[model samples]
Target chain A: MTGPDRPHSPSGDGTPAPRRSPWRPRSRQGRAGPLTYLVLIGVTVVSVFPLYWTLVAATRTNAEINSVPPPMLPGGNLMKNIDLAYDQIDLTKAILNSLIVSGSIAVGTVMFCTLAGFAFAKLRFRFNNLLFGLTLGTMMIPPSLGAIPLYMMMVELGWIDHLQAVVLPTLVSAFGVFFMRQYLVEALPNELLEAGWVDGASTFRVFRSIVLPIARPAMAVLGMLVFLQAWNDFFWPILALTANNPTVQVALNNLGQGYVPDRSVIMAGTFLTTIPVIAVFILLGRQIVGGIMQGAIKG
Target chain B: MFKARRRAGQGSAPYLFVAPFFLVFAAFGLFPILYTAWVSLHAVDLQNPNESTWVGLENYRKLFSSDFFWNALENTFTIGVISTVPQLCIALGIAHLLNYRLRGRTFFRVAMLMPYATSVAAATLVFSGLFGRDFGMINWLLGQVGVNPVDWDSGRWTSQNALSTIITWRWVGYNALIYLAGMQSVPADLYESAAIDGASRWQQFRYVTIPSLRPTILFTIVVSTIGAIQVFGEPLLFGGVSGHLGGAGRQYQTLGVLLYDEGWFNYKLGYAAAVAWTMFVIIVVAVLVNTTLARRRWRNAA
Candidate 1:
């Protein structure tokens, strides 16, 4: 309900978005009406059941898994599965490769996005609108359209099997820049910068002193998104990863071709793969949601 | 003097602040995409790059004439429509359920988003197990109702339908979270006013809530459409490594999968590039239609 050109209207008609329909509904926050906590909790259970299943399945032996109802409890074979996976696939190496590729891509994306976002959001340059529009317009340019050329470019650059091949291509994601710009546009207070300038603070000094601190929450959100994307990414890395520098995902895929469906190790690899994503989400779910909403509303 | 010093000190700062991105984007982002267009014009082969012949419109001609390309196009659209409409609609319903004065709402809200953050690889793996013909949970459930188990990945419709179910399940909750956010933004006073005016909950939703959520709905529609069109990982992982072939007998493949097959798997760089451009056009066109229709719905509802 925020208006760009106008002063804050709060919630459009002065209702202030109602503070989410009252946090607690009278009789008992525990249990009272048809709006019982159990129903919602049930939903929460359903949603997380698959994740729990993944963890459980990671522990079970293939035959135990093939049992009628499937085990609801974790099996003792988790360590064995991990050991087997390490033996068959380069589990440790794959994890390290994933970290390097995803970490580098995430860092590269943040740097490019923040820089471009800072330029677009704060610059008074001519054609700033045009540049931003062009950037935004490129958002609609599907990634597939860029795929063939990107592959050729990688081959030309001799980066095909290199982790750099994956990192370099998606470094300047439009969504990243767009998300950061929107966040900064909201978070940066013009008066502070103007005041800093009045007291002889340079633009860089003002930005450093005034903007970056306030932008941490937003940046963290963008950073998490960047990390999530890099982690979940399959295509470019699959194209890029060789036997030497295979990411976990590619390793798992290749594992399928290499073995006759070793469910124990596959489950282990999948579970290991999911951990980083879950950790990131646990830490920064709110920022992710907020940043995403901010980006969508404004952009 | 202070202002002058300030201006001088900060004169190049903005450019400095912004250069890293522009440089990287130029090198990796802009350059390759532009080169892809040039590549799309030629008869370039990844295996034999030196034998590149600049056959003008030849790649485009070949892509346009190919039956597989058309099939991919059709699959992409069909799957996108099937998945997107239901995904967003159910997402809206889930959002509403969450918005309703449900206890443990916060739990549901967060639970709903778990699917969104889940690795597509893991989820697809899980889904493939669930959709297994012999022992899938789905087939078991179907058998309890006395329906025969269908070969979920064999026939065109069955395969695409199975793929779309996974797509729908993964996405519906994600979209619901989006709708929940949008719903949270709508002024409760509007609902209050509607309530006061003898409008029932459903009517308030039909009249007030839906109207306020038009922009959000439009946003979701566009996002869902793009997401569906770019249906890569599911088909790639579950469908096959040779994703361009789409599905078994090429029935379940989307444009994204097809684009990969042509460009990377098959080495039909030029033809694949054309296919990519075709997808780009389709996505743009779909976005346009989504926006137009959303606006119309908003207006008519108003």
Candidate 2:
């Protein structure tokens, strides 16, 4: 198949056709008509408008934000509102807390999932299928079912208002293991392991040198996904931590639910919470897109 | 010597490698889920969780008899349908558009996914602001079209619709990309054959594309249904101050918010556990129903 990004040549091939056919089916697929572009542009606008409006609202004063036909354009109060939100809530601490929590969870999930996935995919062991099936089954079990007991456990452990309370429960996801296992099954060749075995390399050594290198791409993808999930996770974090110590999502929630409703300040807090992830998306979007598509095919 | 070393390594290496997951799952996952069942059978106060009185089936009975529980269930179902149906349909359309080779293909895909990158907290806050009863952009836009302003927060349908809109906005792009991946895998010759038979684009889409995308569509539907069943963050944040109650009249209280409200707000741990288990059963039933229906459809086709 031709690459999606390649432009459709008039002759419908890299080498010019001797003459164009009355109906060129192959190139026609590549040549989207005007209506298609119009629809796509419409969808794009709808997709982006809310985030854009968040920026607009964040820059305006509450009075301007609350005015009818609300300020479409940004006002000059961006920094002021941000400052107000910062003063009202410990946003900087929240961001730092989020980074630490998400970072640790991401690293932990990737490490544990890769190890488990490698074993599931390549190694032969007792109850291998049974164990792997259990892992997959766990994915179907909703996290909410465990909330009450987990909350009690957290309380018993004195982990309330602790970042670890939020981090530990989510440190290893069943989905991460499944994703890595799928990737490894396809990507890791058994011959490599056999070669290592023949070379007298222990399983751990082979894993460290050979498996890790081969699994790096999948690990990176899983890490990004887990980090995104950890960062955006609200339900557990809100339950575990209070306003005094909150992640970005928890802080944003507090800001939104503040007794004295300040729309602009809330929007400012929303903007602050969202921008870091958006910036990351902007930078690594292509890989993230690729990762999702790749996972879609396998999953 | 090497064979002996390899055998020794193989004997324990896999177990050691896989231990972390099992250990963590035992500690955090399996235990809690099982303990939730235990908790559900007892009346456990949030303040004194250790002290519990066994009230077998009482929480479930109370839930079955409670108006709020029923309201939340109804809200969850209605919101799930409204959100998932339109979201998937729009995603399929977007995917079709994306399949056609367009300039800035990467740009469009990445830009559309920005909402997915935005957290539920951020997205809900932004959407709630936009859907404000007064001075909101949506009402302003509707006013331009001679439509009356909508009290998006108060009314049952409006509030649910607003919550669903937030869900749709966040997920449509992600689902579109999933569908696009499926679309890309459809053999080009099918489309070519259809075109040669003088099929129009709409006909091609109707006959060729949708059939080819059955598994992908089913996958999205199941996934979306699972997500919708657990709809919490959007409704909770959308409620603003009384976030846990969903709305003043419980207009849009999803099962997830109900769980939170019962446990966190009302401090009824036993009742929340019942809600949680009920949700679990509902999800399992939903998955089974989907699977059975899909299998039956496939059998019929066969």
Q: Per-candidate TM vs. native?
A: 0.88, 0.94
Candidate-wise lDDT, in order: 0.70, 0.86
Error of 1 at A18 (Å): 11
Top candidate (TM-score): 2
Q: Where does model 1 exceed 4 Å of error?
A: A1-43, A256-259, B1-16, B101-103, B240-244, B300-302
Q: Which whole-number lDDT from 0 to 100 does residue B63 have in model 1?
A: 83
Q: For residues B1-302, write the lDDT of model 1, one tens digit per residue.
A: 66664545445566677677667766666666667767778887878654567878888888888888788788888888787888788777766766664544544555667777776777777766667687666777788889998878677888788788778877777777677667767756576666667776678768876777788887787778878877887887675443446655888877888777876677777877777667777777888988888778767866
Query: How would you encode candidate 2's per-residue C-alpha lDDT over A56-165 as one tens digit per residue?
Result: 98999999988875778988998989988987789999999999999999999999999999999998888789999999888777775688899999989999999999
Clashing pairs in 1: B246-B253
* Local accuracy of candidate 1 as per-residue lDDT tens digits, A140-236: 6555457666776677778877888877777778888887787677667777777877876666677678877776666666777787777777766
